[model samples]
Target chain A: MDKLRQHIEDITALSDEEYAYIKTFFTAKKVRKGQYLLSEGDDARYEYLVLSGIYKVFYIDEQGREFILQFAKENWWMSDYEAFFREKKATVFIECIDAGEVLVNTLQTREKLATEFHKMEHFYRAKLTNGYIALQQRIKLLLSSTPQERYETFSKMYPDLGQRLPKKIIAEYLGVSRETLSRLYSR
Target chain B: MDKLRQHIEDITALSDEEYAYIKTFFTAKKVRKGQYLLSEGDDARYEYLVLSGIYKVFYIDEQGREFILQFAKENWWMSDYEAFFREKKATVFIECIDAGEVLVNTLQTREKLATEFHKMEHFYRAKLTNGYIALQQRIKLLLSSTPQERYETFSKMYPDLGQRLPKKIIAEYLGVSRETLSRLYSR
Candidate 1:
């Protein structure tokens, strides 16, 4: 797709012929809101690049408490990555928050493309670098920031998300109670 | 730099000449225990690949409480990654827990190597892939696991590290009080 082309080109340029060949590896899928892309114990066979909507990657604890790990938006990637990369059964769930299409690629394709195209390898490394930084930032936030500080950081970092997501989800992401989130909101 | 060669070879094969050229980009340094490899406000110019020794990458909160983000052992990588990649002032501290040697690498070197050698690109990508998976595991633990569960996971993941690290530091890493860690240790 043109979108997939644009996404890869944003990291490393590819010729029209190269793009055509590379694009063959990805398959498009339409997802409805509330549909599950991945569930615990399922084989995580593919990783997704969102074309249009929001999604959440989460895990459920023994007591059935759900904890959100991260959100995926348009142009973002999402998967139960541990399972996807290691070929292990999924320990997390990926659910569609808003209906949209995503382009899916399997591990075999990722390896084949990278092995064939040096530029593709470069593209993947670049993306991983950014993802690594983001996860580090999240760890720092989780380890130290106060609840109010977290709310402020979250709103600042994802202004659109803050406005669009339910406050309940926002509170869960921040590791705060609904009442605490309400107090912060009133301020 | 045989260690460096072996590290790369573990992910992808390289010719002798290629390995020689690639090794030039890395410089080895001997670190002393208690010395700080990186500190808040430093430029975070290099990422370190441990050859021998232990290191902690951490941050101090406004309340002056230290929070450990991660520990680096032999074959592990450590850096103020946000600052390393973004070229920003460091916001974290990297301190040596045991004196030993490490291979230090610059961003310029990493980018040059990856761009010049496709194998190098694949090598870096593979390493980042593992790093990303480990960070995801950390996030999952932080969000849901109980202290006892976290302790068990940590011990199982790093049996040697469990024996070597001070319980205080282990407690910090697990987000548990030292007393809680002591209780876990007793059991």
Candidate 2:
């Protein structure tokens, strides 16, 4: 609950009574490495805020290739957002990369909190604003950057993720091969 | 302002009084073809909502190659959002392809409107949510799709944009050449 309060307060202040009410909407769960938090065609009913460890949100192509959308870390949120927001089946999968914990809440909780508290709405808006900016940067990089530039940009953007994850995973995220990542690393 | 009302009401309802107050924050501007609404290094202090016209939001690389971030059509909004939200100088250019009109608003106006009305906050959050989903799909397409597949997907996703835009620009958007796009069109 302290972590939740801290995360929310990072963007907007919440009174003690408000924080108490907000805490009731979230449920915490422990995750195991290699566990699937969400899978394609599942309900996609909930989004999780990482308390500890790492998770990757991705989708598998027709050829069974995985395209990583995002790697969520502590205080970060992850979900098949399109599905979650639309109340549809999950289109992407969220897999735990490291065993840890997450605070989970359903879309109902999100809407409820947002409706009940203007600060919560503002908090959500701020988070989305940052997420939108990051995604736009990703698009800009994809449109123009070379593999070397991609590696450098990714490293600069998510130094923590780059250090924690294997080169193979980084390559997938960069749309390059593991050997290519190895070469880049050496350079 | 009717169009603005319609657009906002599509997401959340607003009273006549609220619409009157909201409309005061936006200014109408006529755009000419070949005009630059925003350019790299300029202050991107405002976002434009297209009344009617086509504009390309893009950036040029060191090699003088252009990468388009998005096309703005009627009811669409465009800006160097990273700069717009962060109050930084523009890192991209927005050039008008077709002459038309737009309703413009500043970040301060946006904040004021959202803070004044809960429905306005909901309206903005909903728009950002959709934009987030759209950007995520773009990333997924960039991650795995081939040029041909990109063309098809682009067409499927934005049929109006495909129909309205020239093949050369579409090729640029798909990260392919005009000849490649022509070949795809034939197929």
**Which one wins on DockQ?**
2
Candidate 1 CAPRI assessment class: high
Alpha-carbon runs more than 4 Å astray in model 1: none
lDDT of 1 by residue, B1-187 (tens): 5788887788888898998788888899999999999999999999999999999998988888889999999889999988998999999999999999999999899889988988889888999999999998998887778899999999999999999999999998987789988987688
Clashing pairs in 2: none
User: Highest lDDT, which number?
Assistant: 2
lDDT of 1 by residue, A48-160 (tens): 99998889888888988778888899889989888999999999999998889999999999999999999999998999999999998888887778899989999999999
Scoring only the A-chain of each prediction against the true A-chain gives TM-scores of 0.97, 0.97
Worst 10 residues of 1 chain A by lDDT: A169-178
For candidate 2, the TM-score is 0.98
Model 2: residues with Cα > 4 Å off, grouped in runs = none
